[model samples]
Target: MVTERLSMRNMTKTYGTNTVVKNVNFSVLPGEVHALVGENGAGKSTLLNMLSGVTMATSGEIFVDGEKAVITKPTDARDYGIAMIHQELQNIPELTVFQNMFLGNPKTKGGVFVDKDREAKRAKEILFELDPDIDPWEKIKNLKVSQQQIVEIARALLANAKIIAMDEPTSSLTPQEFDRLAQLISDLAKKGVSVIYVSHKMDELFRVCDRATVMRDGQYIDCVNMKDMTEESIVTMMVGRKIEKVSHHSYVTDRVMLEVENLGRVGTVKPASFKVHAGEVLGISGLVGSGRTELFRLIFGLDKPGLAVAKHTRMSREIAGLDKPANGKVIVKGESIKLNDVHEAIRHGIGLVPEDRKLEGILKSRSININMGMPSMSKYTKGGFIKRGFLRKKSYEIMKGLNLRPLDVDRAIGTLSGGNQQKVIIGRWLASGTEIFLFDEPTRGIDVGAKSEIYDAIEELAKQGKAILVISSEMPEIIRISDRVMVMRDGEIVAQLEGEDINEATIGQYSIGQAKKQTEAVL
Candidate 1:
């Protein structure tokens, strides 16, 4: 019989009267890449938290190397050779890569002062093993999201961790970066390290994981071999039902609701033009740092817009504008509106669901009702007093419409899963009567089931004749939901694809400038 490297018998967790994680059994073999997958609120996070010593299990027996281990704190887990890398990284942005790597426990000289040379040397060695391009002397703030993730992994490796659990590791990675990460995981497993990989991306799980443990509604379902299961089968096991593939239909109308002419930001976004119809979903696709988010910020009035120097001469000649050659103009409902700030954008009926939901989107400490009604508070208030009853009723109605889990408007938004928190953000805009919606990485870090729900909501909004603009890193998501796609490269829109032209291959080529090079060659 093969002895498991780690095992949890009948693990359970509870808070007051509510049990978040029911009795479940899990085990991982040495050098095995195991997958822990489920929908949001399905107890995957709770289980991992227990294993990593973030939370204590109410009832469970943890065995490491066939010996019982009592891990009550993060230090204990670290001592037991276990590490957890959360989706939201724990590195200090102000510190250098090596400093962040040795944040808690640093190499010391004479047991007093930190040995800077020794720390840097060890950090460089581990970081180089993962990605040689990562400079240990560089500040964490200057590094990309993928590079920051590698630093976290290198830190764990430096600590001689035998088991590492990563949550949504590839959520921010580009295809090339993901490939590198996949290779690193394979290497780690070869070195007798156990990896508990958690993600909503099915293709990734199938590629890197050898076996998968499925959970639903806090209950243990079953563990299955990766080769024996299909995406559809695994999804069914997660959701307890077969989810039908949503067929996207064009809802575009002839009436253009939003139009951008010569929209540009100096040193950021290049001069670009496009139009979104009243009932259309336009997707912006590009590699990281392609100005997709910057464009959205300009449109939403979060940032000031400026003309690219190269376009000023030509644009000045085309449009005879008096005041210093206006960089761009935003037209809504056939009227040019000055979007000077976020309030101006909101007044013009534009709502944005920002990419970093936890940071910019929602007030985590507030209740779901408060978050849902925040943007439209005036509508739910009278005579300097909040209409609590009316607000709750409206919030509950919207939550029900969005299929929010638990259906409790009074619950703290922070306590909810990523999917439900996203629903609250969408519900807020709906209450504000937003006409044009801008979703940035709308489904990022959410589960597959929640992704379907979000797609449905976008479809419904489009069907209602509301103009929608989406910026996403996922190519398949762009192809599946977009009526048209705008591919950006180096802060410029390179290709605008529609219908059959919006596949992964076409987007890939355009995103990397291959299509542009080919076109230039032909010209």
Candidate 2:
């Protein structure tokens, strides 16, 4: 008989007037990988935070190994053998991997002076279990994102945690690293440690979990064995409805809005090329570690495509036998121009909604007014000085356009929900007068209601002839908005589907780098 390791009864959480988590009941059995998945702000993280004692539950009782437990603080959680790895990593950059792993529980000599050598040895042993490739002496700052995650996991295991929860642990990890994590979860489960895996990625959950618990708008929706469901079915349950099949509207025009000729970033992104016309959204998709990001990074001038050199052979012989696409225009409106940088990409009608919003998108300290005013500040600033009054008024205008709630210009940007924060970023660029928008995972951490709003925003942009480039992990999203789709694999445009050709299965195939020969081609 399977025994429950952890259980939460009538778990509820509220923030002032907002009820984020509501009467949620959940359980994790010993040696089970129980997955919790939902759109961002659906209360998944809130419940985890409550269980980990990072935040107090408004009303609830927790049972550990059938014994009622009290966790008022993080230390209480630690003592109860409950550990969590947050989406955003928190490690002292200056500390060594060994030191960070044994942070709070330091060894003491004669119960007074610290014993560094002994702690380092124990830390090393823990790292060996989590990831043998990581060096104990390496500085925490020097580790890759994935390695840093491993260090966090090692730190959790060091506590001898019976229940370890990973919150989007693979968000920054490579595909190989994610596979490694799957195995590590399996290994942890085998050792009788109940693991709670929280992620938005369907593929990862489907591959690894034994059972999945879903939440929606801060309420427990359902719990079911992984074997009894498909990804589509799981998503349907989480969202509370069937997601209609994505249809591509066929009135595509050949007037190319953007064209990349022989774009290259050697080793990172090969000399790749593609074109996107007005009303068409080219979707660049790939497994983690593939250079989908690099290809766009160069195009947006964050990095050069190395085409300025006079020697490299680039483009076909027909376009004047040029060694590269240098001196050739990325031509918007037949105007030969240079993108000063990413900002210039927007100035000339391009806005990129980056994949990792927490890192590249959100500005926590500023208010909604300041955030939206940033990209397009000409109306609010004069001779390098900003006019606060003007900017505040303009912020309201942008908010009204996006139909943002609360309409509070004075509130700090971080206080808003994930979807609202995303809208603020988009609002900034729209104010910048950008005709083309590059949206990378526009709905990543947002909830279902917010997702519908964002999709409407995308369609609205397209109707205004705003050429949008959307790179998304969500297949339904890629299929829903893109008038025509182009899939990227290993940093190259592997497949281009248009009009009657765009469908979930085909785009999905191209997304995972299998669009061509093993074709499940459908319209």
Candidate 3:
């Protein structure tokens, strides 16, 4: 007979009068990959927090290999051979990759001085097993978000963790990276390492997890084998309702609301151009580093556009005082405008929901009403005073339309789940009266139910004649909502597909440079 590797019996957590998790039971067997799944705020994070010793459980008993274990701090969890990789990464930005990997536990010489050489060597070996492109000596701040995620995984592996909990680990990874991670998980399981995986993506769960334990409103619902359930069944269990499939119908208009001509940014973005009509959703499809987010930054004026010419040629043109190198032009409503900064972009009726929402969007400590009303403060200002009641009323309306949870505009935006926070961000631009919307990974880290709601909101925006330009790493989302799709690869828009041409196969082919010549024509 085999005892369970880990178990949580009647686990309960309470914050004052609020009980976020109640009588929840979870278990993992050695060599098994168990999925902890639920909608945002379904007590998944709270439970994981308790298991990882981020927070103490008010009531419950934890068992490892049939022996009760006490985990009161992260160090305690580490002592028990458990590691957690949070969706919101916790790496120190200034530290080098190898240093961050061996942060809390470091190799030491003579049990006193730090052994940098040994740490770097081990880090390189682990990173090679994960992603060889990552350099162990590079600062954590310099790596891409995906690379940073890999570093976190490498840290866990370095600890030789018997049980690892990952929260939405693939939210920032590319398809290739995800495949590599899946293989890694399989290999670890074979080595008798149990993994507790938490993700909002159903497909990923089905692909990687051996079994799933579903939670709802802080209560344990059911646990099922992956082979016995389908995606629809699991989603219904998660949200407590059958989700209606979202269908897309073309809403494109003849009036072009936003046009980009030869937008470039030196090494990051090549000369690229496209037009978005009044009522269209133009989906930008690419891998994580395919310049989708960088292109959006240029369009939103967060970064300055650069001349596509060679460095020396650009310098010569600047010296000669020639007409500003015809690098790019942003035309709004047939009027050519220079978007030199974020203010200029907003003034031109353009709003960006940045790729990294936590860093670039939403003020977490502030109330949802404040965050929603930020871009449109002038509309509610009278005599240098904010009209609080009016702003609250307007914010409630937008929140209701988006089906935002809790319905409390005064709640701190940070306390909400990933899906609700995304809703509030989208509501921000809606309140701002933004006409051309740029959404980067809008549905990332959000559940199926929330994704449907966001898609509906985007459709409604298009119906209102707002031109929507979305950058999504998920190809299914692109195929679902986009009226036209732009496939980018290696900093170039390689193909534009509309109507019959915009299937997943075609888009995937273009994204990886595997498409036929007929489809290689650039827009």
RMSD of each: 3.4, 5.1, 3.0
Best by TM-score: 1
Q: Which candidate do you rate higher for TM-score, 2 or 3?
A: 3
For each candidate, what is the lDDT? Answer: 0.90, 0.77, 0.88
Candidate structures ordered by TM-score, highest first: 1, 3, 2
Residue 265, model 2: Cα distance from true site in angstroms: 5.3
Q: Give candidate 1's whole-model lDDT.
A: 0.90
lDDT by residue for model 3 over 411-522, one digit each (tens)?
9999988789999998999899899999999998888888888898899999999999999988888999999999888777888888888898899998898974243443
Compare candidates 1 and 2 on lDDT and give the better one.
Answer: 1
Report the error of model 3 at residue 363, Å.
0.8
Across 296-334, the per-residue lDDT of candidate 2 in tens digits comes to 676676776554445544443223233444533355655
Angstrom error at residue 146, model 1: 1.4
Q: What is the lDDT for 7 in model 3?
A: 95
Q: Residue 106, candidate 3: how far off, in angstroms?
A: 2.3
Mind giving the per-residue lDDT tens digits that candidate 1 earns over 273-336?
7889988999999998899998899998988887434455655534422124557888888888
The reply for model 2, stretches above 4 Å from the true place, is 1-3, 15-19, 108-117, 228-243, 262-272, 287-291, 303-329, 380-411, 448-453, 473-523
